[model samples]
Target: MNIVVGITGGIAAYKAVGVIRAFVLLGHDVHVVATDAALRFVGRPTLEAISRNPVHTDLYEGVAQVRHVAIGQAADLIVVAPATASSIAKLAIGLADDLLGTTILASSAPVVVAPAMHTEMWVNAATAANVATLQSRGIRVVGPGTGQLTGSDAGVGRMVEPDEIVAAALAALRPRDLSGRRVLVTAGGTREPIDPVRYIGNRSSGRQGVAIAGAAALRGATVELIGANLEVSPPPGVRLTEVSSAAELAAAAATSAASADIIIMAAAVADYRPEITTQSKIKKETQGDRLRIDLVKNPDILAGLASTRHRGQVIVGFAAETEPDDSALLALGRSKIVRKGADYLVLNRVGWTEGFAVPDNRVLVIDLAGDIVMEASGSKLSVADRILDLLA
Candidate 1:
């Protein structure tokens, strides 16, 4: 794959190094086009070293070869990370003042932009218009995530992580087989509050769920991510709703499932919660060493959605088990498929050192008769694609 990475002026330009490196490591031929202002944040030498190609900025450097236009001509994909408001405006209006601009204008390949700016600038009418215009022209836009900003300020204008940017770019290059579909994905471990300070929770990082949501969005689906205590940021280009408890998750799932063409239950929802939630922090001394608390079972969110799903709506459920033996794990997963009434059940072995918070996972996709439909193992993102393949 030939990838052209564009770095624009923004404090977040420094982060584009990771984006370039990610593509490079994936065996993609990467060419970087950085603005002069972007050089102020990340030096040309660093960008060149990581990309293993000379960084292009001057449109006059290779006039004989028509470098500006030629770079785009040979490119399979073009990505601009830390796309500043100025650069976005230039692209939106088809301005070609610089090498990056000219290259983008000359390209027929898919164009992906990762916008990073202060909240005020991002939400400004001009920027919004530019973004809207770009999207209208078939360009793909990633995040502008919500988080701590350059200084004391913070909002929904932070650049998403580099890996996520790469994921979005990859997705943009893929065929939109899932176009016009609505996908609802649940992620993270639900926390059942026992007190103001403490609660029962699992170790799920929500990476798999986030990956699934991102995959669906990349495949042209309208994605709604019902996240609970996520360790990772929600992928750019998906609707995210945050929840903390199983009850909240149930309600959120129920609501989103109403319009979903596909529902993936990837969250590690708690099976039980404290019967009585203490408003104040429980005192350790008063409770003593052997304190006992009443617990109650949580609602079966997946089963409820499965039972109510419209015909043709696909319901996928997850089974994360600790059983080391394959046969035992398969048995448990098979039972779950029947119990949940899901169209497909993904069963994975999870241990303290392996699954919960890790980036990689191995899963067996099972059907209602306890038969294995498919087996997959790889980065969560790859597994997500295979799962989506089942639907496709």
Candidate 2:
């Protein structure tokens, strides 16, 4: 794959190196098209080193070979990582004053832009209009996610992380095998509330589940994501339902499962919840640090869905265990799959450091016959695609 990465003048331009590096590591032929201002923010040498290609900035430098247009013409995909407001305006109006602009204008490939700017500039009516116009012309906009910007100012207009940008860029080039398929995904760790201020929850950051949802959407699935206190945002094009407790997740999943062709229960649901949830915070002084709250088991959402699923629905369950022995882990996974009666069970060891909040994972897929169907180890996104391959 030939990918042209366009970097604009923005603080987030520094992060574009990660995007370029991700593409290079994915075995794509990467070329950097940086604006002069972008060179100032992120050094040309750095971009060249990461992309494994010389960075192109000047439109006039390549007039003889027609490099400006040729680069874009040869591109399978064009990505603008830190697309500043100024560049967005230029792109909206078809301005080709520089190499980045000319390359974008010359490309027939799918163009993806990850916008970066301050909240004020992003929310401005003119900027919004320009963005809308670009989208109207079929430009794929990744995100200007809400977060910290330059200085203390923060809101919408922060460039999203590099992995997300790379994921979106690559997804555009993948075959949409999941088109028209409805995928139901549950993410994060459900919190069982004991009081208004405190709850019992696992260490799930929702990276794996969120990655699955993102990958599913990228494969052109109509995705419904039920997230229980997710640490990350739902991928672009996914219908998101926010829930905090096991009961809420169960209810949401049950409601959404009927129409889904694939159901993946990835959320680390709490096995028990407080029998009585206090309206006010349970003070340490009043409780003497030894408050014993009665507990009750939450519903087995995966089992229920698997048991009652309509014909042809592929139901997948997840088990995050601390079992250290490999054989024991496989045994546990196999037994759990049989008990839950899910079509497949995904098993992974989650200790303090390896899983839960990490970006990478190692997992085994257990079939109903106690066979290991698939084993994956890599970044969550890659693993997610491997898991989806079963349904795909």
Candidate 3:
């Protein structure tokens, strides 16, 4: 993919370096086009070094090649990170006063804009009107998240993280099959507390669940992610609810499921939790060599959702097995689908190296009747997209 990254003037412009590197690392040909003010924040040398291409900031830099119009015409996608209120107004009004503006005006490829500015500026009537105008013309806006900003002031105008911008850009290029739908996903291993300092938890990193939520959001679903101790940041554009125990996860899942069109039980929720939680930390020296703790069964979130789901709602469950053989795993998965009353279940072999903390996954999607609906092997994101495909 050929991607054009437009950087405008903002303190967040410095973060655009990561945005460029992210696209390049994803195997895309990246070109950085910055405004004069953007160059003041992130220099030409740095952008050139990361993108591995000559940075363009002037409309006349490559007149022989007609670079201004040519670059945009040939782009597969255009992403403007740290898009300032100034740049937003320029693009909104079809201004071509600068190279970045001219190139954007000429581009026919999908455009994704990530806005960053002070909270007041971002919410001003003029900026809001410009944003509405741009979106009315089919331009996609990523975010201006609320957090610490340039100085002592902070609110809704912080630029989202670079990986999120990349995710949004890629999402903009895909089909919007899940648009207008609400999706609920759970990820990470639930941690059950035994004491103030001691707890039981699984090795789940939440990569697969995050991937599914991301893919669903990219496909246009309004996603609510119930994450439990995730090893990674939740994907951009999803509402995140963080939890630490099975009970908390169960409550979150049950609450969000009421309005979700699709619900995925991808979290590695503990089947059991410590029967008793001590207020004080357990000490090794005081209770030398021996330890015992009772366990209690956790509510089956997936089964409960499946049983009470609306007639047209779809519920999916995930089964991680160490059954050691394909036949056994398949049998277990088939039985689980029926037992849980879920419309679909994803079954995967997991152990120390394969599923828990890894980036890729191998899985079989089994339907309620024990039929294999889809089998996939690749990065968790790919698996996520396939799951959505099946849902569609």
Q: Write the per-residue lDDT of candidate 2 for residues 35-133, one digit (tens) a residue.
A: 888988999989988988988988888788999899989999999989999999999999999988889888899999999999999999999999999
User: Candidate 3 residues 130-201, lDDT tens each?
Assistant: 999999998899898989998799789999989888998998887999999999999999999999898899
As for candidate 1, its clashing pairs are: none
Model 2: clashing residue pairs? none
Question: In candidate 1, what are the lDDT values of residues 226-332, reduced to their tens digit?
Answer: 99999987887899999999999999888888899999999999999999999999998998888798999998999999999998899999999999999989989
All candidates in order of TM-score, best leading:
3, 2, 1
- TM per candidate: 0.70, 0.70, 0.73
Q: Which candidate tops lDDT?
A: 1
Q: List runs of model 3 lying over 4 Å from the truth.
A: 1-4, 8-12, 21-40, 43-76, 82-108, 114-171, 323-328
Candidate number with the higher TM-score (2 or 3)? 3
Lowest lDDT block of 10, candidate 3: 20-29
Clashes of each: 0, 0, 0
True lDDT of residue 83, candidate 1? 92
The Cα RMSD of model 2 versus the native structure comes to 7.4
* Candidate 3 C-alpha RMSD relative to the actual structure: 5.2
Regions more than 4 Å wrong, model 1: 1-15, 21-41, 44-168
